[model samples]
Target: MKIVDVICTPGLTGFYFDDQRAIKKGAGHDGFTYTGDTVTEGFTQVRQKGESISVMFILEDGQVSHGDCAAVQYSGAGGRDPLFLAQDFIPVIEKEIAPKLIGREITSFKAMAEEFDKMTVNGNRLHTAIRYGISQAILDAVAKTQKLTMAEVIRNEYNPGAELLPVAVFAQSGDDRYDNVDKMIIKEADVLPHALINHVEDKLGAKGEKLLEYVKWLRDRIIKLRVREDYAPIFHIDVYGTIGAAFDVNIKAMADYIQTLAEAANPFHLRIEGPMDVEDRQKQMEAMRDLRAELDGRGLSVELVADEWCNTVQDVKFFTDNKAGHMVQIKTPDLGGVNNIADAIMYCKANGMGAYCGGTCNETNRSAEVTTNIGIACGAKQVLAKPGMGVDEGMMIVKNEMNRVLALAGRRK
Candidate 1:
């Protein structure tokens, strides 16, 4: 079969899943507020609009599939300008990528992926979001074409018997209100096991002792989860730069906190992520090294995933060279393109480092699925998105595909 046609579905929306409900100074009490206002003297507010984008693919054999391509709310090239990215890319899919594939073979996923990559490159400036759209639409189309589930494809290609356990992530909202340190810990601890136990008490309040109790309670909850689940589902922490620990001075405290988390975590498995205010590459690596050393001394394993600190290839190298961190938390756009993100993952893998695909709060369904494809191609072990992972339509597409693949292999069993 040859390529046939690509069409973009109209409608795009923005949604904010900020854990913090209070306005925050984006930087150093910067006084940025999201009062649902258009303009605030020193605050950056979100209009909280409902915008969405979807696309349709018509294959050569008269087959068709529809899916979302919006990356997290403000994703892709011009993030804050989703309307523009959608305006520009939707046309490309309709006029360029779709038309070329109208008569092409759809038997090979790799071939289809390559075709899109080539098309993207030829366009001079390729946006991963565009390629993401093609990859996702085709995956849906191919799954339909072959009548094979997405999990089946993954199992056949990668981890055949691997089950996709529930992934728990600490959700972050732009506002800081939801970040009441103790409440955040308790809520996350309750995520996987609210039925059995509610970590927070009826008259519970926040204080130093209460905070310590909350941490210890979180630890117990983590350990209990490990004991109950056959496979230890991974837990992700989104610091969101809320940790007031200064890199140079508070490295010990950071390490201590991690150690407490690791010990309380019965299965002894935990991964922590942050966009800490380390300021620069050298400082970031140093902080990681110190934290890693502290964790090692306590026989606790930690995968220090870098978020904001890793903006480019050079940044990745610094972390790898110094063994500052064991995992590279890649934000899709920061790697420039999907292929570039793939290269970074490959590099990390070759060096025996783990890589995770992460996203910000403002992601749409279209973009999430695209990021899912990117994660698969880049060899990511897992992904970190909102806890209500598949709420977005874009994410739902990938989630459906993964479920299909897993179901086909009986992994869900």
Candidate 2:
């Protein structure tokens, strides 16, 4: 069946996700302050709820399938305002995207996404948040027509006969306060059985020594309280450019910080993210490649991950091909199009770079579920459990999808 009309429903609000499970540097997310060093800095997100849009496709046969839009709270091409994005995206959908999709056949999900990407190239710089909604809606329509799970469709189209495996899960868990940290350690170790990775990625402000000290405390606490004595989960940290900012292009200084963190996290490896930030994708790749080489040369086991500037497939590929970073996050919301995220993961796998499928905390349960399935289907290293404050919600959605897909695969076999 051909497409009929595409409709967007706005005013769906989502809670901003927690920042690395750690106490944020500035004003805390949702206005909850963990460290009360009152400086009207506002580095953390205060608004937990923001309006979003849900795009629905009404086929000529009157069948409907929908998709939710997830936008970052503080960062995006349009500057983190979902309401503004929803408002600005309406015309792009109606005037540009919808017309192109109106009479198009919906046989290939991959082809549709690629065609849409081409159509949106050049002057059509519509943000990925908008593209995410339309592409998801169309994919939902395709899945409905084919009678298969979202992950199944990807397997059939991209890697036929590829085996489906359970996606290894990671939960955000870093609270500056001892009590919060205590709670997270217990939950991550005891409560969540498959959480092989305990993550903490956030803005740490500008104190290098203080950052180093705190991470030491964190590593010790987690190792001490961990459930499996033999199994030490990966300690992943995303600083969001604070490390590079503190050193100010001093590679030696950055090396000192990395070495300090490496020493503290010794025996248990560390995955550090956003060690530097550059606006230009090329410059960002250069910085990442430099750091990666530095770490390798210094015999540091720290794995560098690129997040900020590598928001699209081509950018991610550049980072991979150049060996700029050990791994790159597919960054689901920023990249949109579930198929693109899947393709990016495959690209990383083929290129020998690590792949992690991730999304903003600004997503919903529905969007989170979609991401979970896509990441699991594509066999990503890990999928960021999202669309909520605590990890349980994202974890629950991800686990449920795994069970569902497992059942589907069993039936098909």
Candidate 3:
């Protein structure tokens, strides 16, 4: 197959205004979106309000032409300006990079991938994003062209995908464990009168201390589970890393806390999600090393998964070089593109570390599906469920796709 054309689809960016009222009013439902007044009915209620850019990959072989597509929905975070992405990132794929791919023999994806990197020089502003879109489209093209299942192509190219069972550890800040009572109520009950009451109030309310209490309640509940339970199996915990106690829990305290939780709950592993402030690559590695040393000293045997620091490939290499982390959490959009992500994963696996592709709260299902496919294709050990388990509808989409992929791999058998 040869590249015939590449197109960009433009639209407004979307903002997600969740029904805080519903969440405040109702109890949680299957860890997905809660049902109640304030919350939107489902995922579609999550809307795009501003402009967005979508790129389509058009390919031709002999007489046939078909399109493969990728889209980037931009939004700002942490009070920062809208991350000036898309346009800055897309051209790297549609212009500078796509032309080189046009007449090349399409048999070797690895070779094509190498060429794409060399041609772009890896320092382009949109290198990661563009490569991601381009790589995703190309992978689809290659799979379609060869008539091979995506899983088949991936397995042939790299290691087999791991059986992924992701667990959720709600991000909370503080001492009170039961902070989000509405969500708790929704999760545990089928119907709630309180949801109606809160929904009427019209403000999505979350008391910081109360939220902490809710998280503590959740943590304590999980801590109550045995290593091998008939019901709640030992799984993983994702700490958005805010403990009501302190953000910087000393190494000993942090180690002690992890060991306590690991012993009590016997989780498969613990992933500390972030907002850690590491000024440069060296400091980042030091933080990882420090955490690793503490874990080793405690003899906890829990793996430290890196998210905040492993934002780029140089960061990944730094982590690998300094013996920092046991695993890496890769956010596809954060990294920019599929090829760059592939390089990161390959770097991890080839150097004897594991990779888990992370998901976001804001991703649409279409994007979620593509990430899952890429997670397997790129050899990530596990993939996080998106839209979170709190949004029942979105969770269902993620769970269904994840289950389908797992079933294809005969994980249940």
Q: What is the Å distance of residue 134 in model 1 from its true position?
A: 2.1
Candidate 3 vs. true structure, TM-score? 0.64
Which is the leading candidate under TM-score? 2
Give a tens-digit lDDT track for model 2, residues 121-239.
45755566766666677677888778788777777777777888887666554333445456556655222211111222333536565656666777787778878777565667777
Candidate 2, residue 117: lDDT: 49
Query: Quick one: how many clashes does candidate 1 have?
Result: 46
Tell me the tens digit of each residue's lDDT in model 3 across 163-213. Answer: 333322122111122333233333321111111111111211122233223
TM-scores across all candidates?
0.65, 0.80, 0.64
Among the numbered candidates, top lDDT falls to 2
lDDT of 2: 0.69
Q: Candidate 2, 148: how far from true, in Å?
A: 1.4
Full ranking by TM-score: 2, 1, 3
Query: Which model, 1 or 2, shows the larger TM-score?
Result: 2
Overall local distance difference test of candidate 1: 0.50
- Best of the two (1, 2) by lDDT: 2
Residues 1-413 of candidate 1 have per-residue lDDT tens digits of 55467667656443532212222323123333244432322113343333334767776677677655444433322222233245556677666666677666777555565566556446464455565455666666766777665424433444334444432322332222223323334333312211111112211121113323444555555545443444343444545333423222376666665565556554535666652446666787887767666667777765666654676666776687777766777665444334445556667767877766665444555455555554554456665443222223323444554444345445425
